[model samples]
Target: MPTATIAEDDDGIRLDRWFQRHTKDISFNIVSRWSKSGVVRLDGAKAGPGDRIAAGQTLTWPEELPVPVATRPTEKPREPLSEAQIEYMRAMVLHMDAHAIVINKPPGLATQGGTKQPTSVDAMLDALQFDAPSRPRLVHRLDKDTSGVLLLARNAKAAAFFSKEFAGREARKSYWALTVGVPKIAAGTIDAPIGKQPGTGGEKMQVDTEAGLKAKTRYRVIERAAGRAAWVEFLPLTGRTHQIRVHAAAIGHSLVGDGKYGGKESYLTGGISRKLHLHSRRLVIATPGGGTLDVKAELPPHMAESWQMLGFDLQLGDIEIVEPPPPPLKKRRLSSATSGNRRGERRSRGATDEPKRPPRKK
Candidate 1:
């Protein structure tokens, strides 16, 4: 018998699917027959086609049968990255450890590739492999024009753990932006629902309270440049596309240079940079083994210049502003007779506040 050890990248995959990836010539029918005959074994134990395999496990197959090989065309080889490309990718690294890599992704670079997008952070992931058994995985994303701390998982186990943290809202993020005008409320929450607009093929988002997903953002006015613009810090409670932008606009203080949702009013005068002034400032999330990964990324050049021109102090003290959750709906105390069943059930019929008319005159 011939045996092979599973790789980390192939962990938690079905036995049949693993064979299909490694040996394209092996059909499902053949694998099923081999499994039933006990020719396919995992660690000397009989394994089935549907059995999930893990890393470091041993898989053995009969040697008497012909070797399974791929008859399909080979995949195109990845191009070698240039020295400049490697430097560019590594320059953005803010922190790196056994399980995670935090990078300050620059503005104008898409997190992932799309139509007509030739380059992206995902495409350059190969450059950041750096002795890992597998390529790092993107746990979350930032917009193309937004710059900030982007975390990447170095392996599958870490990837799964980080993804769960994000999905469960265990991760906390803070953003800094230059708003067109001072918000009426200095510190408060913007509880607005947002959804994809009807037209534009989902390219934009709008506040659709009637049919939108719940989105909340807590903001504090960090500093004010007279009444023209204000430096704001945002903490989002729910992850939604363009949530901060739409919510900021909903409050009548759109982020500076955000024309998509803010319109022309977003552009600031007095030599302020006409670029979207949103930057992911801080991220706090739990790591796989233990402890937490908290990192802060520096502002990009354009935004830094804008801040300097506005006379906003980067070292100014600020506090974490969290909005208190809405109060619970008051419960209607049901009478003992109706307590056992749902409300309105087991209730006396025709019980009205008005005095019951005497059974006069049938």
Candidate 2:
């Protein structure tokens, strides 16, 4: 019999369910057929279709069934980094201590490997021998299009520490975005609860009060441009998936170039730019040595151009603070006439103008 052992990642699922999860292209009917045929067994005994399984359970299946493929090994031949890539990495590596190395990852480079892509930031860091061991470990991740500071821990211990710090919200992260419109208030907080949309291919987040997680984002408008756009700063208090992007879009002003959240007009045409305008401008953390660690990333090429077009100079120091435009006009509450006819019904019921004539028909 072809024997297989359940992995830690497969804990808390059923035997038949585990098969379905592992075999991507296969259907549940196939899994049931295989189980009924005795091709699949658990712990040298026949496994029922409904049997709940724990981790480390051994499973046996016929060799005729194709083996689930493993995660593609990180080791693969890659062309040497281009001159530009090398320079990018060089600029990103702000501080390298014995415990950790930090990098300002550029936009468009993925942090981890996926099915289609062979190389990733981790692979590149390994190739560069940034860590003593053959493999360098990623402590955290940034979105594929997000250009910002990323942390790498040289050892597993350091990785665990940094991971805890992030989970505990001990690290401070600040992002700068050029949004399509200015917020009505100069500074305010968004405390909307966020929940993932169902059946939307995992691409949308909605503000839901009933079944959503607590999400808060503190934002302040830094500068506004003739009602065209505004520069804003964001500090997310919670790290739900796509929290910043979704929250910004929920408030009506999507970030420039954010095609996922922004409407059609928010997209930029040719010769303008193709990248998202959000940037992880700064990160502050407490070091193991009790010293405050602060790092900042300069604006990438696309944002730099956008800033220049808005009449801003890049030679200025970090954290450019600009004067904001006037606040947007607040939406007016509708009068009773426009709101609805509820009051009209009440007024008509109370009127006594010659209504006694109707009693004769009764």
Candidate 3:
């Protein structure tokens, strides 16, 4: 991100107004959201959109922040979205409607921004608004480097509706990845619990079996390259952070190039790129109003390149889907009649007694 130093002439400008004046694409709504979401910082502290700026104050924001509200652009012609960027965003759309939008997001793009994150999908939502008044909101997240289908809610109604589905565990999301080693089993369920790793300043996670939230993932090895690596498909039953990656690592088949959990072996030799080899391949869920939303994303560039290099088939995960776990059984009590007994009778004395202690032997 680049830093903007407030000049003496532009002192006392509201953060929101500054964006409106300088940037052609950064709307007031985007400014407001960015401020409230902690993506805007003033002198290393979270800033509000209404905050006033003075001379020498430094404002840091995502490098991709749309055109300037700075003094240099107040009298200049408006800058339009570059043709290349417009085309890139247009090509990522898999499906779009009044209620939602499904996009095949690329790798290395953060779903949400943080202190060091200068650009992210959330920051670029303005390009997708089209006829809508407000920007589409993210329903869920994929990891920063894990590319593939990302769902967004186009309006507030859609946002609430999809959020409920995600909360209720209704979204059937499937992911594909290349892992370092082959699993002994071809397919299985991982029922371990996971939670934030202790004392890593809240930056990492672990298999906290002792006191962790429940997380389960069902995986099937779609294709394997012997012991060198395996291409696995995952259906996670829970929404814990880094659940799939951590579970795969715990099972001794860490994803290739995933160092946070995969360790040193994540880096492979022989011309394979050292990038996280995970992609959210598909999503099946109910739409906000009353229909189904099924979308699939193709392999991202790096993964596709790796697929070609390793001789792995890229079309194997086209229709990947897994059945949800069955519901738990209910307990029932038996009545006296059901137990082969009269209502008021007990077992016979002889039947209830030992066999006379074997005639007092020994």
Candidate 4:
């Protein structure tokens, strides 16, 4: 019998899920058959396929069963990366530590692969595994057209921790965008619920107040350009698919170059590139052990050009709003003597300090 101990990362997961993750050669039917035949045991006791697994628990199976060859369609083998491709991935690394890697993802680069997308950051992760025990895992994804501040976990433990933080909405993220028009309300929250649009095969999202997932975004206008475009900062309070884009379009101020959501109105008249202008500017999240991870990414080329064309100040720093704004500066209290003296002066100036009596004769 070959016995394996469950790791903490696999704690509380179903036995079938554990098998799927660790033993890829073995199918669920084989696991179920072995469990029924008493060939699969957990800590010397017969176990079923649906049983939950715990950390440090021993799982044993009979060695007589031969590993079956996969009959499912195999994926196309990935070609090796050239030296130039390796350097390209390395150059995108904005911040790298023991547990995390933050990259400045460029516009038009897909975070993960799709049927249409062949080259993606996920495919190139092997190039990023420098001195690490395994290739980095993606904790979250950036839209293929949107760029900036994509985080990667270096190992399984870090991946689990980061994934939980993002799922719980504990991670704070800020995005910079150039909207087609200035928002009527300069700074406010968008509390529109979002849902996938019908007939689009869930490829597009829309604001469906009646039946949609809760999606909220806080936005502030950093600057406006002659009533044409505005530089805005958006903080998503709740993560939803295409939340920012949908909310922005819902408010009638779609993002510049966001033709899918904004339609013809999304395009600007200037020489700006039609690529999406949304960028994940900053991210703040707690690390695995103790401290916090804060990172910021610079504006991509097309956005930088548009900013310059609009005469926007590049020196203006980011408005940090991860935490709540500090309380307003306290006002100095007036001393009692000073207050009295002011009242006396008002009286001398013919402003009566007491209420006037009316209609005494009546």
lDDT of 2 by residue, 45-146 (tens): 777667766667888777767676543233357577777765566667866786677787888888887885566796577444553653457877888888
The TM-score that candidate 1 achieves is 0.78
- lDDT per residue for candidate 4 within 1-362, as digits (tens), equals 77788776566667876777766567788889999899898888989888877778998887765432232235456688989989999999999999899999999999999789989999999899999866799999999999999999987668878999999999999999999988756665677788999999999998887799988887777778978998888889898999889988887889999999999989998697788999999999999879999999999999999988998775443744333453355843344422423111111111222212223465
Give residue 48's error in model 2 in angstroms. 34
The candidate scoring highest on lDDT is: 4
**lDDT (0 to 1) per candidate:** 0.80, 0.69, 0.77, 0.81
For residues 1-362, what per-residue lDDT tens digits would candidate 3 score against the true structure? 76788764345667776666666677778767878788888888888878877668888877776535444454634245566766777789999988888999999888998898957787777788788765688989998999999999886557767888999999999998999977666666677788888888767888887888998887777777767988888889899999999888877788998999987889999989899999999999999568999999999988998888888766565543334453344532344321433111122211321111112346
Error of 2 at 64 (Å): 32
State in Å the error of residue 237, model 4.
Answer: 1.4
Cα lDDT tens digits, model 1, 1-362, are 76778888777667887777777566678779999898998988899999888899999887765554432235555678889988999999999999899999998998998786768998888889999976788989998988989999897678878988999999999999989988755665677788999987897998887899988776677788888888888888889998888888887888998999999999988888888999998999999779999999999998999889989878652454433553355753444633533211222332222212224466
TM-scores for every candidate against the unseen true structure = 0.78, 0.63, 0.67, 0.77
Which candidate would rank higher by TM-score, 1 or 2?
A: 1
Error of 1 at 211 (Å): 2.5
| Pairs that collide, model 1 | none
TM-score of 4: 0.77
